[model samples]
Target: MITGASSGIGAAAARLFAAQGAAVVLMARREERLRALAAELTASGARALAVPGDVASEADAAHAVKVAVTEFGGLDCAFNNAGYATAGTPLHETDAAVYERTMDVNVRGVWNCMRHQIPAMVSRGGGSIVNTSSVAGTRATGASAAYVAAKHAVIGLTRAAAAEYGERGVRVNALVVGSTRTEMMEQVLRTAPELEDRFAADAIQKRMAAPVEVARAAAWLCGDGSSFVTGAAVPVDGGATAT
Candidate 1:
């Protein structure tokens, strides 16, 4: 199962996972796009189900998981990648609604997914969950303070869940993502075009990541190849965190 599967990194992950033979359940608010992607995958001979819903709502998250179990037989792994961010606003200038919405989609969304996903995973004896954090999760960045704090909370939730559920055979981890050429990043760059060079320079590779780059890392974490890895904030940041 994947949240935010309608576009960007989530959409890329959906395609990658489906191509690799996993029956994918996609959850995002964009019903048309979600169904289109599902149809595309199905046409390519892959199993895909589009469940259009917002991750911020507990009921929606629960329903997505239920669909995954019902259509695919059980939930084995999930990528809780839905997130909201607004940059360039200081905490004082940011409206309370912005802060609440940031926390709702980034932190609470992950919380809701894990709450429902873990049970199905436990029933099947094990599963993997990869939450999306950010470089802002570790330190101050150009993003708004609300975004920074919300991302940090994602990592905290990932670690806490990992520790609590490892014995139960569920592994939880997070990706410390760097500047990627996602739709969100593109929008940010469009607003402040000059930030493009600055964003690329932040990475040691001197370039932004493609969504598929991050999706590959997510796939690795979800597969048996990463069997012994858990509770890790693995970096897919093109060396941004290293600097």
Candidate 2:
């Protein structure tokens, strides 16, 4: 199961997981885009389903997992990747509504997902789950204060889940995602084009990551290859956190 599966790293991870022979349930708010991606993957011989809903809603999150188990038999992994990005204007300057909206999607969304997903995974004996955070998760990053706070909260949720379920075969981890060539990034650049270079220069790679690059990292964490890694924040960033 992949939230935010309509685009960016979520979309890329959906393709990679299907290619690797896992049935995928695509979850996001955009029904058209999710269904279109599902059709393309299904036509290519992979079992894929689209579940459209807001991740912030507990009932919706539960229903997405239900679809995965009912349609595909079981869900062995999940990428809780639905989130949005915005500039950190100043604490006082940030609109309260915008801040609340950010927290709803980025923080509460993950809370809703894990509460439902863990029970399903426990039922099947074990599974892997990944949450999306960002460089802002660890530092100020010039993003809005709310975004930074919400992301940091995600890491707390990831670690807490991992600790609670590690003995039960469930692995929970967070991706410290960096600036990537995502639609969100493009939107940010529209107002501040220099941010493109600023983001790249913050990383050792000196370039923005393609969404697929981050997707690959997420896939690895959810796969058996990272069997021993849990309760940790994995940096999919290009060494930005390293600096």
Candidate 3:
């Protein structure tokens, strides 16, 4: 199952997993987009389900998992990719509403999913979870204070969950994603054209990642290939964190 599967990295991951023969359960606020993607997957003879809802609500998160389990039989892997990205601004100057919403979607949303997903995995004997974090989780420059703080909290949750659940057969990890060419970034650039150059300058590759690039990393973490990797904050950011 993947949250935020309506577009960008989540969409790419859904496609990739379905292509690899995994039935995908996609959740996002964009019902139309989610349905379209599911139809596309279904047309290709892959199993897909669309569950539209905000990840921040516990009820919504629980419903998403329930749908996945009911339709797909059991939850094997989940990519907790639903989140909000606020623009870069000073801590004091940022709007309180945006700050709170950022925490609600980015931090609390992941928490809600994990709270339910972990137990389901436990019941099934094991599963893998990959939470989409960002370079902001490790550094302070890419976004506002709230976004950075929420992502940092994500990494903390990943580590704590990994330690707590590893012996229980569930693995949890976070992806330290860099700048990716997603709708959210496009919106940021539309509002602040200067961000384009700022993002390009931060990475050694001098370019933002495609959604597929991040999706591939997430797929590996979710699959048995990375069976020994847990509590890891894998960087799918083109050397952004290295510099």
* Candidate topping lDDT: 1
The reply for model 3, stretches above 4 Å from the true place, is none
**Over all chains combined, what TM-score does candidate 3 have?**
0.98
TM-score per candidate, in order?
0.98, 0.98, 0.98
RMSD of 2: 0.8
User: For residues 104-140, could you state the per-residue lDDT of candidate 2 as single tens digits?
Assistant: 9999999999998999999999999999999999998
Residues 96-185 of candidate 3 have per-residue lDDT tens digits of 999999999999999999999999999999999999999999999757899999999999999999999999899999999998999988
Root-mean-square deviation per candidate: 0.7, 0.8, 0.8
Record all residue pairs in model 1 with backbone atoms less than 3 Å apart, i.e. clashing: none
Candidate 3 local Cα displacement, residue 68, angstroms = 1.2
CA displacement after TM-score superposition, residue 131 of candidate 3 (Å): 0.2
Instruction: Pull out the clashing pairs in model 3.
Output: none
Candidate 3: give its CA RMSD in angstroms: 0.8
Once model 2 is optimally superposed onto the true structure by TM-score, how far is the C-alpha of residue 207 displaced, in angstroms? 0.7
Scored against the true structure, residue 173 in model 2 reaches a CA lDDT of 96
